[model samples]
Target: MMCNSASGSAAGFLLFTDVDGCLVNKNDYGFAPAVPVLRRLRTEGIPVVLASSKTGCELQHLAEQFELEPAPLICENGGEILWRESDGGNTRTVAGAERSKILRALNGLKPTFQFRSFADLELHGVMAATNLSEAEAIRALDRHSTEPLIWDDAPDRIPVFAEYLQEFGLTLTRGGRFWHVAGNASKGSAMDIVIQHYRSRLTTPVTTIAVGDSPIDQDMLDRADIPIAIPDPEGRFHVQVSSNGHRAGEAGSLGWAETMTRILDDVTGCD
Candidate 1:
């Protein structure tokens, strides 16, 4: 987390948020309850960026439908970034073996580990695993960088699977409810890029507020100027987070809205 200009304290803020369990209902993925706060942010000229383990395609669709279009998006757990502006958009993908190469490496495990990657799953399987609609599952299949795997939690042989993947420069991490495999990319890196973009564009330095609900968002949350941690549906946080930041009483979208409203009151300085 690079230090900003001295005047950053009085400057307005930019937001980098996670979608699944942070901005939306973890169980249903609906974000309607956060609408008023989202609209207020727009009115106050605060940029709301979506950073998530979901693919670029998923975030792109949400950016449009949720009225966050033209906003920068951190996708595939920061495996890729979509920076959109009024003129056009640009993408920066991290250096790593694409999922195809990683998949081949995993396939070398042969009959040892049954590969249950998102690529191999049928619509029903995707729906059952993610609780996403058919259309949403199709959007999820548009992944280009990381492979989201539904591992069966094999202990003894899991080390071997990880070792083989390391040979290909692939790293795996636990995400929402699945295992995400990718190269050396993270949400923090994407946040850095977005923060730099904001610094370059705005005359007044921008403060960043990051909100997340899970361990997957730790990198972004830790790096943000302000970090808000929303609890799980069971009203528990996945990791220790935001001791100084506000906590939402409820979970999911309501929690998201609850926290966002606080931010609006505390930061925006708008009536």
Candidate 2:
């Protein structure tokens, strides 16, 4: 059910977002430009759910900074969740694979493969790779289930890794800068679960809006009632069949706010 937002309209929207390259720049990772839209969303009581390859520590910190607490945030590209203010006590929303299992599978990979997961990257290495401060990188190192990997010079080796992961009932997904390894967890799958949860609580029909920049987000885009594809730093929109939904006016922070602001306006128009 869709409850009225602060606009008093009988419509509620659930926006699931990708944090990197979608909400913030992949290089610098600043979201100042999107602050206004974020504020408006909060004011309207619209739930802004983060679906990212980041860990719960990072997501929780970001959510707290945005005052978006009590909203479950999807992490590790949907392999795990940090449920907030929910009935059930932070259970893994599917993707129940253990961290040890994922690491063990990674160890089984051929030495020729240059794929390095977060588990391999020590704290200092994580800081260097992500450009996050020491504490921030430490938070990022905290993973529950899925493993984010950085594939080096061997692009051809990717398929082989995928094959091995499949044998172990795992899969690989390419995000903006890294690949995510998980079992039966995706942005789309997690969003579906969260959207259904929201619908169960609200009083009106729920409208889901999903936004992202990389191909990693294709499933989420397809699942959204309104899919918005933001351009990359090169200013190219890559989401397949994007014309069927919408492309943002710009890339990164500006595009995120632009598309979100427009959607918020349209929702308010329904009032």
Candidate 3:
């Protein structure tokens, strides 16, 4: 909508992106291909918020690498929000039950379901499952409000498992890597809150560009003024992303760079 309106005249733009399969290539976990586009967006003064199912510790560390110091973060699939205040103080907003409670509920369902959660996998197992380094694995295991697990049960039973989770005030969603169980909070709601945080400080309307590569990011893409969908490495996409404003030319980091370069160029007339 902003692109159709007056892109150059918009007050500001907020870029909310999922980490895996969107910014970072899922295979290699590298984002070098997108670094140039990210740098361009940074130079244009756009704030890029990393929204992912990753733990706060993981997201915080990745944010530093992406140079998103003051940008807000939506972590654990929007179970938490972290940002820096104007006075250089850090603030955190948490949603849903804590990890312990979620794990307790999950433990109760273990007899009925066949799954291995991050808690069960521990550090070494998590590293093997995610192909992350020792330090990154440690960060991934430090979750706050969500439990990511590999579901070994029948695929048809996912709906029933979701129903069972509902009774415990939890829900299930699929991410690029694993299934995530979390509270009622979602990326869309978190985006709204962060947008409000921006609107309250700025005099002009802030345009939002949301990008992702899986069903986990559907809610976020639905809420964005401009939604960009990046396909998986095999060039496949989820069916729920019918409303996306732009579909990338490639998959993973290459696609991320491709679509974002176009959008930024179109919106800001920036080279």
Q: Top model by TM-score, which number?
A: 3
Which is superior by TM-score, 2 or 3?
A: 3
Question: Candidate 3 — which pairs collide?
Answer: none
* Best-to-worst ranking by TM-score: 3, 2, 1
List the candidates ranked by lDDT, beginning with the highest. 3, 2, 1
Error of 2 at 248 (Å): 1.2
RMSD of candidates 1 onward, in order: 4.5, 3.3, 3.2
**Model 3 weakest 10-residue run by lDDT:** 1-10
Point out where model 2 deviates above 4 Å: 1-5, 86-94, 241-244
Report the C-alpha lDDT of model 3 over 156-203, residue by residue, as the tens digit. Answer: 999999999999999899998899999998888899899999999877
List the lowest-lDDT window of 10 residues for candidate 1: 1-10
For 1-271, candidate 2 gives per-residue lDDT tens digits of 2334575752577888899888887888888888888887878877889989888889888887766636878888878877776453454554547777888888988465777788888898888888999999989888878888888856887898799899998888888888888877787888878888888898888988889888778999999888999898888877863555788888898889888877777677633
Full-model lDDT for every candidate:
0.78, 0.81, 0.86
Query: Tens digit of lDDT per residue, candidate 1, span 103-219?
Result: 787677657786588867867788888988899998888777788888875656667777777888888777778888888888888788878878887888678888887777888
TM-score of each model, paired residue for residue: 0.88, 0.91, 0.93
